[model samples]
Target: MTSTEAPLRYTAFTSDPEGGNPAGVVLDASGLDDAAMRAIAAGLGYSETAFVTRRDEAARRFRVRYFSPLAEVAFCGHATIALSVALAERLGAGDLLLDTSVGEIPVATGRDGSGAVVATLTSVPAHSRPAGRDELAATLSALRWRAADLDPALPPHVAFGGNDHLVLAAASRERLADLAYDFDALAAVMREHGWTTVNLVWRESPERFHARNPFPVGGVVEDPATGAAAAALGGYLRALGLVVRPTTIAIRQGEDMGRPSDLLLDVSPADDRVRVTGRAVPIAQAGA
Candidate 1:
């Protein structure tokens, strides 16, 4: 492709044009610099974008970078899914290694029973720690959520997979549904703590959850689908001994906002990492 040809990209996690988190996919970005990449991602105006440059075709490993419209991100799950499918279309489906800025992510791709290409990525290690009372209170204040709305059982904490996320479990679905926060206040707190997103979740069942992610650091109000936070939630559940290992949990996100998305996470007893899987569809190019 020539430089004049706008980068060939796609969005993942939603089949419909209007649904899911939109991601920019550049299957080949060998010649692009950081400025060029950031510009491209900004031009696309997606939440996050993936730039892939093959490092070793034989090994099926590629160096990847993630960028939001405004800046670079440590890792992005939906973009990873989109890149894997884009690669599969050209290189055939199987396993591929993505050497990201955070760490190496192993992704497996295959056609499901319905013939849709499904991709699963194993996150870098997972861990969670207590969120100080002061921090939690400050976050709640920024979110305009009262302490009574918090779930006592789940509590508040910071979880990490590839990046750090502050997790807040709501006492009711209604509380989680009404999301309005001081964007600048939350962004300040998140920046000070090096947090990528504030993962707000409400447990619907033992195996099901409703989630919303406030990504102020990325200059977005909310992320429709967040894979990294999903992995972190899996780790949080395991750390709290809330769920059985080797079990899968379904996360229903973006529904309240109208762009519904499904994220499946697999947790295992033997390892601390979590696996997130989903289907990604390419967004058709808009007529210029």
Candidate 2:
């Protein structure tokens, strides 16, 4: 293998290569500067890519950076999951400490029921605040959704676990499924509000949910699998007392897009910690 080869690619949150959010993984990015990483990520055209600058084998610690097509992100949950799975395949499944732009993120690796490698990430402290009425109205207009379509149970709020996300729970699954919107308009609103994505979701049941994320800020129209948003959603749900304490909720995402991704979330009321779990797989090169 050449020392200067391009980064490895992998899909996160799904077992199938074509069914998850694809991300570029640079195992050894210590030599690549910010410009180089940005170029590489842009060339790949994925929602986000992860660069591992340093790794501690015995300590299972990694210093990582995430780059979207346009700019560097504070933290990317899917890319972190992919990196953990990749590291687990090589170093054996265990725990990992990640140093990120936002804060230190702790991740663990294990096997799922089907024996697929699953990585569970414990998000940093999460908090949510009510969204401004004017901003909320603007966001709703950009999304082409009326306030009536919103679920009364879940009020509008800007939630943050790692990145800021606008949480708007839909009144029905159909409202969440119909996701066509003004990309530029929504992008402008999100940019103005400093939101990473708009987390549109619907509660199918007390413990199950359907979500779709519009990520125009990241240069992607939509994100099939979004773990960061999920973590934020967990915090929002708990803070609002929408769910029973200490329960695991299943989040179904990317289904409308045909990718079909699943995320398991455990939220505890004792403290503001949300644990999200998903699987990742390496994407085979043209000819391996």
Candidate 3:
């Protein structure tokens, strides 16, 4: 039944298709089962594919799931943003309630300063815990970074917004840019720890940061723009007293990979949920 359906492709966190993380979107996946959904995600071969099972036009509510090329993800930030913008373009900008495996996420879609449709997703909740010495040591060994390379101020933390991400702050931008990891070793540690991605960041200023995410658990070596990781980092910073609440953070990612992406995050004092905003654009069809 799903054989006739072709997923729409979009790249999120950038205004241009060539600059952001690409995603596969199946707007109507009512007839698809888990097997069919997995197959579609495998075929699309993006970091993640989103399937929408239920859509209420009047209420702008949806039931969604995220599947990577290898496995199903609990939550996917870029895909949510992409799907939100896609829905807005068709139904007009407004708010949407997306029900995922993790929890219900409320997203608001609107026009940015550039007039491009952008989506902001409020995460489920944010939490942070100390990164144990053993975990940090193993991760550093896999990443080939010594203790001297870590930022003394930032420390180490395992942060969660929707999914868990290990946050490591590099002492310098140069150290952050040189990312070469033992894939198998890193993957093993990530699997053991149930980590989605390792959020490696370098602070440019109080408000600006540069980040790279190694998503070994998802079968992706790196993620260009990681909204979940960004949110997690925001929470981590707040937990560590690096920043105050009710603040906005700007993260620049994917520059080293040639696909530049921007993620804007808002952390408020009222709640633990973090808001991540970005624009998504449809990719031009190959033969069109």
How far does residue 153 in candidate 2 sit from its true spot (Å)?
A: 1.0
Q: Which stretches of candidate 1 lie over 4 Å from their true place?
A: 1-4
lDDT of 3 by residue, 125-224 (tens): 8989999999999999999999999999898999998899999999999999999999989999999999999999999999999999998778889999
lDDT of 2 by residue, 1-288 (tens): 122787888898899988988988888888889999999999999999999888788998889999999999999999999988988888898888999988889998988788778899999998899999998999999999999999998899999989999999999998998988999999999999899999999998989999999999899999999989999999998889876668999998999998888899999888797999999998998878
- lDDT per model, in order? 0.87, 0.91, 0.91
C-alpha lDDT of residue 123 in model 2 = 95
- Which regions of candidate 2 are displaced past 4 Å? 1-3
All candidates: TM-score: 0.96, 0.97, 0.97
Ranking by TM-score: 3, 2, 1
Clash count list over all predictions = 0, 0, 0
Writing each residue's lDDT as its tens digit, candidate 1 over 141-255 gives 9999999999999978899989999999999999999999999999999998899999999998989999999998887899889999999998888888886658999999999
